[model samples]
Target: MPSIHKNIFTIAVVAFLFRLLMFFFVFEHSERTIRPDTPSYVRPAINMTEGHGFSGNEHPPFFPSAIRTPIYPVFIAFFYTVFERDVLIIAFVQIFIDTLTAVLIYIWGRRLFSESAARLGGLIYSLSVEQAVHAVFILTESLFTLFFLWAIIAVSCYREHCRLRWLVSGGILIGIAILIRPIALFFPLIGLLFIWMASPNMRWQFMRHGIIFLLIIAGIVVPWVIRNYLTLGLLKVSSISSYNLLFYNAASLSTDLHRISQAQARAAINDQVTKELTALGWKGDELHSAQLYTAWSRKILFSAPIRYVYIHLKNDINCFLPDVTDFLELIGATQGGKETLSVLNQHGLIAAVNHYFDDNIWLLWAVFPFIALLGVTYLGTILGISIQILQKHWDSLRLLFLPAAYLTLLPGAAATPRFRVPAMPYICLLAGIGIAKSIQCYKIRQQQRTPI
Candidate 1:
């Protein structure tokens, strides 16, 4: 086999086996695989396959849902129909998709940097604890990551070749990704910016291409918006954004102000919203309720705007923290979250450290490797980005850095390592470049020291 083909094959095998092992380990502890939101996805999927249409009402009448998007649930529904509603089957499919994503990361690295960098990037992504754990869970992260990766790769291709076809492909992939997870809603705008930056001299030409790219994304997404309008009477792609704003974003802010737990703040806000709605003679419909939630959330979030911004930016930092619980939870090393982010949110950073050692001191040996890998990756990313900045490597920044920053920042206070999955490919690629560059620098220094 050619060297490139051999490297790709090796990466694929390692990724497959690693994810497969993690899946089996989770299978042995099946309860750990199910999360609070698992039912939201799985139940709607099963409802679809059972002829109830796309609903997650969890009761008779099975009303159509406007909260979650269609593609991911439909993706799940197809698997449930074929595989008899087996979670393991769904996990296996995710593992296969994630493996492809890992290989694509290698391709992304090769395009941006060197052969060795791509190989290393692919390996780092494959062995990621976050990637492995989320692959086995009944969540959108794994599948969304695949589409997200392709979408970004398509953008890079368009940047290099300035081809209309690449824009169309990227639009389609990003549209699919948005359907799977609404967090990608603003990414198309970023794509346009990247295009504009890529060919600054050809402003008018790139602008035309940018508009066409956006139109393709709109064409893909508008049907879903129309469906939502006709069915729910709401002109929104998904109601999840409102739900997150109320429960997560607002709740986090409330927690900081009230000095109460997030759960308590959520309950309090729920009661307050319910009372206000009742007082206003609310009809208790999904559309009006979502509108109310968004309004109330914005009110609360903006009431203490400075504090909310502080909390949002502070938690953005949490995106990079290593959470070994992804593995430890499956292997039964710990129960619930004693993660640094969780404790830090509740009791501050000092307390978070104390709590980690206090509760799971014995697991330090297992956790160290994940933390070390995280540190190394971040160090490498810093180096890689530094080099790019020094060289004025705008393509690398546009392709990798912007998306990473956008994905990392957009999650706000809800940021977690799981939320970091979409950004991992770019980060790993940058780390690979940094490592490769550092080695080259070291070799040069060594040669200079040696006798001629």
Candidate 2:
């Protein structure tokens, strides 16, 4: 066991080193100096350091707050205060946080699974060029992923121990995470399910725990809600839904060639979109602009729900496929590459292929098979465990389903391999179980082969 753990530690170290090297070499050269959303965050961080509140004006406070989370910009702000402003320092700090996230993955895995499985998860995550590449940019995904995983680990610890403090701490952390990325609101629901699973026999006890947990989460989130209300003069539950509705509706329209050709027509259509959002209670010039840019998107969904669903289904399929974008672009397909991919591909085919391969090797091989196997393993594990708690069946499974459902549902709307990163840890846990079971079977077969 000691040797096994040592080996796992070695693997984790090597994986971290490799990721660091890649970040310095390949990613440094190929990645954009500024990410698509960098300005939205960096400007806010600067403003905050200069005594402004967490207001970016271009985006909600959550995104800017992300810059403050993980304490990166705080450190950067200190340096700027002492000497001068240097954005590169923040970028380097982000890389450090990104690496720290890999370490956290290993720690979380080791606690949840065996050292070997933890090592495997760390190895996969550390060497993940997709994650490495993303780390180079000043994007929220890396930091969001770190906090999100930390929340999961904290909640899982609470599940194992049934400690109210851990549960409350997990709620606070998740609330903070939601402030960084509003999508994390699903976590509280997931937590409720977990509480039910932990206290199956005591029905009132389960509800009591759940209600307390939710109240704790609300305590953390309410301040942000108040801030938004005061700032916008309207109660907004989440800043993302309006943005999502706009983006999804707009992106869905890109599937039509005729729509793609008429740029002027689309521009006019987008103006109507702003009018619609204004009618829907969306406010602010920035919000109005995003709505206008994506107005044509409404046509795709509102025009034909069934057809839009069918098109999204096809998109989900293509998201998993290995085909390159230039091939699609050559044929005049409008749906292939978005801004990130277009920027990556501007250099040439080699750069494009490298980017695709780095970001999606898991999609090319691991994710699909793991997803297929996940259904079986998750069901088998849940059923096997739930059988032990048959008296509390609903409580046992609800926590797992709510978060899992939210995680699964998001990918269908914007199907990309990168979008699936948050769920990979869970998938890794399932895959680890399946692999262990296969090894146990092999061990039994070998034992049977021994001569009497």
Candidate 3:
């Protein structure tokens, strides 16, 4: 194998080892503590494994829940039947998933960018503390990242090969991704934009392939939509989206009005939203309430278009700075078996991360660089992609899905570092390319400056 491939393997190994070590040490605090709460994903897994038919019939059991899609829980249940809920073993699997994501980044970078950029992107993703941090959790992000990256890779393959089969495969992977995280439901639509742009002249060609992609995606997703319609009497895949919008709208309004600090105002808004849902056949149904509240959210968003723009921009910028306190709490939940969200009542995410590493030079050294890179990459990706569009280069345009994904997922409750993790591989790619371009320019300048 070439040195680059060998280095990629080494990064993957180190990522696995680093995650394992963190799970045993920093995450768990060296001893297991009794879990304070059970997550929603666990019940469906247990139910599915015990022949309950993919239902979330535990911890406020809902018969035929349309609140969430079943893929991640089914994922857990599959392993549970074999390993019997070994947390360490689960973490081991996450390590593998995370490593695979890094390898995919390398492939994506090489295919869409230069070999050097690909190596840099892969290395950054492999060693990413933020990405690895979530690996030990039982949440959907780790597995979601895996399928999401592969989908991107498969899409890249379709573009390069121009094969209808590859296009369908990409759509299928996206279907699976939405099953894991419903927020991804609209992600497939991006293909439409890419397809038209790639072959603006060959309208017939792009439309034919695009229809195949969408039809395959619909084939994968329509069944779940039908299940939801049959069970919940709603023509939707999941109701969580409405709740997500409500939280986003509520948070943005509270922030914009400076009402989050006022307990009565927050409660009043939440209560008012709840009542609005109740009026719309919610009947104390969380799922239906989510759908109803979403309507209210859109109404509010449209009512104040300028404010909505400001809110969107604010949340977009905030996506880069993830909440450390919430993340540490997430770590406590995963490793220490404690679940709490009280830290959210405190301060900004940047301050929280800084406070966590207070006076720890060793950790600060590692963490600061990561933060710096995230900021730089966020800026670099924006500038680089904008340049590409202006120059009319369409080769790497599909990667816009990263920013699109980020923006789509951004309008919820609040932004956190974890929320930003999924898009980082692409950010790293653009930043890697940016760095390579800068070095080349510097070399050219130096050569010109040489005295003859």
Across residues 304-368, which tens digit of lDDT does each residue of candidate 1 receive?
99989999988888788786656677667776443456578877767876675567676878778
Error of 2 at 152 (Å): 1.8
Candidates 1 and 2: which is better by lDDT? 1
Error (Å) of candidate 1 at residue 364 is: 2.2
Q: Estimate TM-scores for all models.
A: 0.95, 0.69, 0.83
Score each candidate by Cα lDDT.
Answer: 0.85, 0.54, 0.66
Q: How do the residues 129-228 of candidate 3 rate in per-residue lDDT, one tens digit apiece?
A: 6777777766777888778777767777776777877888888888998888876777777766666666556768878888888888889889999988
Off by over 4 Å in 1: 278-284, 337-342, 356-358
Q: On residues 218-242, what C-alpha lDDT tens digit does candidate 2 reach at each position?
A: 8977876666556554345444555
Quick one: best lDDT, which candidate? 1
Error of 1 at 101 (Å): 0.8
Better of 2 and 3 by TM-score: 3
Worst-scoring 10-residue span by lDDT in model 2? 326-335
